[model samples]
Target chain A: MHRIVAFFLKQYPFFLFLLLEIVAISLVINHNNYHKGVLRLGVSEVSGTTYEIWSHITGYFSLHQQNRALAEENARLRSQMPDAFKASDRKVFVRDDTVYQQQFEYVSARVVKSSVNRQRNILMIDKGVNQGIAQNMGVMGSDGIVGVVQSVSANYALVLPVINVGANIFARLKSNDQKGIVSWNGASYHYAQMKGIPGHILVEQGDTIITSGQSVFFPEGLCVGFVTDYVQSPGDNFYTIRLRLGVDFNSLNHVYVIRNLMADEQHNLLKENGDAE
Target chain B: MQNSPMLHIGRFAALGFTQILVLNNVQFGGYLNPYIYILFILLLPLRTPPLVMILSGFAMGMFIDLFTGMMGLHTAATLFVAFYRKRIMKVVIGVREEDYLGTPGIRDLGPWRFFYYAGAATLTHHLLVYMLEVFTFINFWSVMLRTLANSMVSVVFIMVAMVLFERRRHG
Candidate 1:
C-alpha cells in the first residue's frame, strides 16, 4: 500500500495530464455543436462583447469598402428583379397570388467572431435563438453561401463554415448541372475541393457552382463558387475539381441566416421512407 | 529559486488576457497564429510542483479554448507540454546542469538555452494542436507546413517577449 501510494505520488502530474487530455479529447469528439453551443455561450458572450467593441473602432476604417460591396450586391439583386425582365406576352395576365409559398426566410446578423486558419473553423454571429436562428440553418454572406448554423444559444450562434474540413455542402455546376460535394482540404481558404463529380462531365474553368438544393439547409441557386481547375486519377471515375469560393471568408462581417420552414417535415418524411426501405 | 505565487497568478491573467483579446485576433495568411499564451507554462518557477504546472496548463488552455470556441485543442496541447516540460528542459539544458536551472527565461538559461527550451515546447504544442485539429493525414503536407509555419512565428514571438518583458534577476 505504501509503495503504491508513493508511486502515484511520484507520477501524479502525468496522471493528471492524462486525465485532462482525455477529457479534452472526449469533448472534441463526442460533444457536437449542440453541447458546444450551450457550453460556449458564456465564453462567447465575453469574447463577443470584446469583439463588438473592437469592430466598432475598426468599422469606421472599412465603411467605404463595405458600402461599395453592399452597393454591388444591391445592383446584382436589382438586375435579377422581376421588373428587369421584359414580358414577352403583354396580353397574358399572370396571376401571381397564393401560388408560391415562401420556403426560406433570412435573418440578418453580424459576425462577432471567426477564424479561418483552424482545420475545423467555427464562426459566431450576434443573432441566436431569440432572433429565430436555430441549429442546421444555412448562413449566407452578401456575395455567396457562408456556412451552416451548428448550434444556437439565446443570443449567439455558432456557424461551421465551408473552410472547415468537416464541412460538406452539396453543389452543382451551372454549365452542365452535374452535382458534387464541396469540401475543404484543410489547405487554402481561397480554394475548396469538389468530390464525387464523375469524370465524364465536361467541367471548364470559371464555370459557376451553386447549391443543389438537395439538402434541407440551403435552397437551390445559392452561389457557392467557380471552378478553377480539375484532375482525375488514372483509374478513378471521379474528377477532383478545385473551386474559388465566392465568399471571402477572411473578411466576412454581415451574413443572413436562412430559416427553412419545411425542413422538419421533409426530414421526417425522408426518415420514414428510409425506415420503410 | 521559488517566485511568489502572486507573481505566477498575475502572469497567468496577463498572458491569458493577451492571448484571447490580442493574439487570437492576429492571424497571417490564415496559417500563422502565434500562441504566446504557452509562455505562462514555460515561465513557471523551476521548483514549482509538477502537479501545479499541469493544472495551470489545463486552466490556461481551457480559458483560451472557451473564448475561441476551439472545443479542446488548446487544452490538450498545453497539457501535453506541461506533462513533458521537465523532460524537455533536461534535454535542452543538459542533465548535469539541471540543478543550476531556474525559471526558463533568457536571464535564467541564457539566450541559446532558452531558445532551445522554448522552441522545443512551442513546436511540440503547435504540432499536437494542428495534428489534432486537422485529425486526418489526408493533407499531411499541408498540416506539416502549417505546423512549421506557425511554430516559427510562435517561437520568435515567445523569444522576443522573453527578452522584452522578463525581469532581470540579480544573483
Candidate 2:
C-alpha cells in the first residue's frame, strides 16, 4: 500500500492532468441535465450577444441567396394558400414544439463548422450558451427540419443533423393520419426512410410527410419530407417509405434554433402519469 | 542567449492563430476542416520531453475544443501524434539505438527524407482522428471518403507549415 502511494505521489501531476481532462470531457459530453450557476449564465449571455453579432457579419453576404429562396417559396405559398382550407381545414397548433405548426419564433443561425459528407454529420451553430439555446433544441432552415442541439458554449452549439444514422423521430404523412419512424439510411443527406405505416394505407409517390408532434423536440406539424419513392417487402404488408428532405443541407446558410418554455414541465407531468413510457 | 523568448512564443502563436483564422474557414464543401495547427506537435525541439509534448498538444486541443464544442477528439489525436513522434522519426531515418537521442532536424536528415518522416506521422494522426469521430456511425464507405478527403487537405497544409518553419531552423 505504501509503495502504491509512493508511485501515485511521483506521478501526481500526470494523474491530475488526466483527472482534469476527464472532468472537462464529462462536462462536455454528458451535460444534458447539468446546469451551471447563474454566474456562468451571465457570462454566457454576453458571449451570446457577441456571437450573434458575429453570425450577422458572417452571414450577411449570403442574405441574397436566402432572399431568393424565400421569394420563390412566397410565390408558391401565394398560389397554394387557398387550397389549404379545402384539404381537411388547416389548423394552427397551440404548441410550438411539433411539426404541426406553420410559423415559428426563432433566431437565424449560421453554421461555422459543418460536416455533411460524413456518416455522422454534426453541425456547429453560432448560437451558443448565452442565446437561451440549450441541449436538444430543434433546428430548421427555410426548407425543413435541420437538427438537434448537442453541446453549447457561451456563444455556440453543436447540432446533430437528421441525416446521421443515429437520428430517429416520430413522423407521419401530412395528408393521412398514419404515423411512422423516420430514420436515415446513411446513403444521402437528401433522403431518409419511414417505417411503421400500415400496409393497407394507400401510400403514393410524392405525398408529403411531416412531424407528428408526439415528442417534445417538435410540436406537431413542420414539414419533414415528401414521398419521393417507396418499396414494399416481399412478405411484409407495410411499405418502406422513401422521402426527399425539404432542406437543402449542402447549401445551408441560415437556420432557426427552437426553444420550448414548457418542455421540462410537460416531461415531468407525463412521467408522473406513467404516460412518458 | 541569441534566441529571444518573445520570438519563440511569436512563432507558435502565429502558426496556431493563422491555422484557426485561415484554414478552418476555407471549406470548399462542408467536407473539410483542416487541422494544420497540429504542426506544433511535429515541430517541437528534440530536447522537449515526450510528456511535455503530449501535455502541450492536449492543452492546445482543449482550447480548440472549447470554441468548436468537440471535447475529446482533438486531445486524443494530438496526444497520439506526440507520443509517436520519436518512433516516426526512427522509421523515416534509421536511428542508432544508443541514446534516446534528441530528434533529427532537417539539417541532419534533409528535407527530402523528412518529407516521408513527417508525412507518415501526419497521415497516421489524421486517420486515427477520422476513425474516432466516425466509429460510432460505422458506415465503411462514408467514413473512408471523409477521412481520405480530410487527410489530403490536412497533409498539404501540415507539410507546408513544417517546411516553412522547421527547415529554416537547420538552414
Candidate 3:
C-alpha cells in the first residue's frame, strides 16, 4: 500500500491530467443537460455580450447585401397589403366578427453569433426573454425556417438551428400533402435528409418542402427546403430523401422568433386528452 | 524575457477573441473550421509544469467553449493537446531537457521541428474533437477527412503566425 502511494505521488501530474480530461469529457457527453448548468449560464452571459459587440463591428461589412434583401422583402410585403388591391363593386359587406385572430406574434432579433460547421450548431441572437423570446419558439429567416429557440437569458437567446443534428422539423411536400421529418446528417449545412415518405410515392427533384403547421411551434407553409435527390434500397419501405435547405446558414443575420399565442391552450388541451405530447 | 505571465495572459486573450470573433465565423466550403486557438498550449514554455500546462489548456478551451456554446468539445480536445504536448515536443525536438530553456518557437526549434510538433498536436486534437462531435463510428472516414483538412489549415496558419511573431529569441 505504501509503495502504491509512492507510485501515485510520483505520477500525480499524469493522474491529474487524466482526471481533468475526464471531467471535460463528461461535460461534453452530457452537453444537452449541461445547457442548464451554472457554467453555461455564466459563460453565455459574458460571451454573448462580447459577440454582440463583435457582430456590431462586423455587421457593417455586409450592409449592401442586407439592404438589398430587406428592400426585396419590403416590396413583397407591400404587394400583400390591402391597399395594393382595388376595391370590388356592388354591396359586398365583409364581417370580421371573431373569424380571425392573431395566432402567432413575431419578435425580430439579430443573430449576433452562429456556427454551421459543428454537428450540433447553435446561434445566439440579440433578443431574449426580455423581448418575449422563450424556449421552443420557432425562428424563421426571410427565406425559410432558421431554427428553434433552445435557451433564453435576459438579453440573449440560443437557437438550435435546422442544420444541427438535434433539430427535427416536421415537413410536408409542396406538391402533395405527403409528410416527412427533416433532419440534419451533420455532413453539410446546406443539405439535410427527409424521412418517412413511402417508397411508392412519386418524389421528383426540386419538390419544395415546407413546415406542416401540425406543431404549435411554427405556423404552416414556412419554407423548409427543396428535394434534391432520393433513394430506395430494394425491399425498403421508405425513401431516403435529400434536401437543399432554403436558408443560407453561413450568412444568417436577422430572424424572427415566432410565439404561438394559442400554444398554451393547445398544449393544455393536448395534455388533457393524453394522446399528444 | 518573453515568458512573463503578463505576455501569456495577453496571448491567451488575443487568441481567444480572434478565435471566437473571427475564426469561428470563417468556414471553408461550409465545414472546415481551423481551430488555431490551441496555439496557446503549443506556444507554452517547454518546461512548464504538467499541471500548469493542463490547466491553461483547459482554460483556453473553456474560453472558446463559452463563446461557441459548446461547453466541452473544445475543452476535451485542448486538454488532450496539453497532455501530450511535452511528449510531442520531445519526439520532434530530440534534445536533452537542459538544452532548451524556453517555448518551442520557430527560432528555438527551427522551422521544421516546430512544424512537425504543431502539426502532430493539431492532428491529434482535431481527431478527438471530431470523434466526440459525431460520437459514432458510422462516419469514420468522414471524421478522418475533417480532421486532416482542419489540421492542415490550422498548421498553415500556425506557421504563418510563428514567422510573423516569433522572430526574437527572448526567454
Off by over 4 Å in 1: A31-38, A41-43, A78-90, A275-277, B95-102, B169-171
Span of 10 residues, lowest total lDDT, candidate 1 chain A = A30-39
Model 3: how far residue A87 lies from native, Å: 2.9
Instruction: For all candidates, state DockQ relative to the true structure.
Output: 0.66, 0.33, 0.80
TM-scores for the candidates: 0.92, 0.72, 0.95
Residue range with the least summed lDDT across 10 consecutive positions in model 3 chain A: A32-41
Native-vs-model 2 lDDT?
0.68
In order, candidate lDDTs are 0.85, 0.68, 0.87
Task: Determine the TM-score of chain B of model 2.
Answer: 0.78
Of 2 and 3, the candidate ahead on TM-score is 3
Q: State the lDDT at A168 in candidate 2.
A: 83
Question: Could you give candidate 2's per-residue lDDT for residues A79-171 as a string of tens digits?
Answer: 778555455534752435485643335667777655555445667677776778788788887777887776677776767788876678888
lDDT per residue (tens digit) for residues B41-135 in model 1? 99887777877988998998888888788778889899889878878888877534553456767886779888888899998999888887766
Provide the global lDDT of candidate 1 against the true structure.
0.85
Instruction: Give the CAPRI class of candidate 2.
Output: acceptable
The lDDT leader among the candidates is 3
* Model 2 lDDT per residue over B1-171, tens place: 213335445655776656544565566555677777666666566556556766767766665544343446566666666766777877776655432343344545567665666677767777766666554455666667766778778777766666666534432
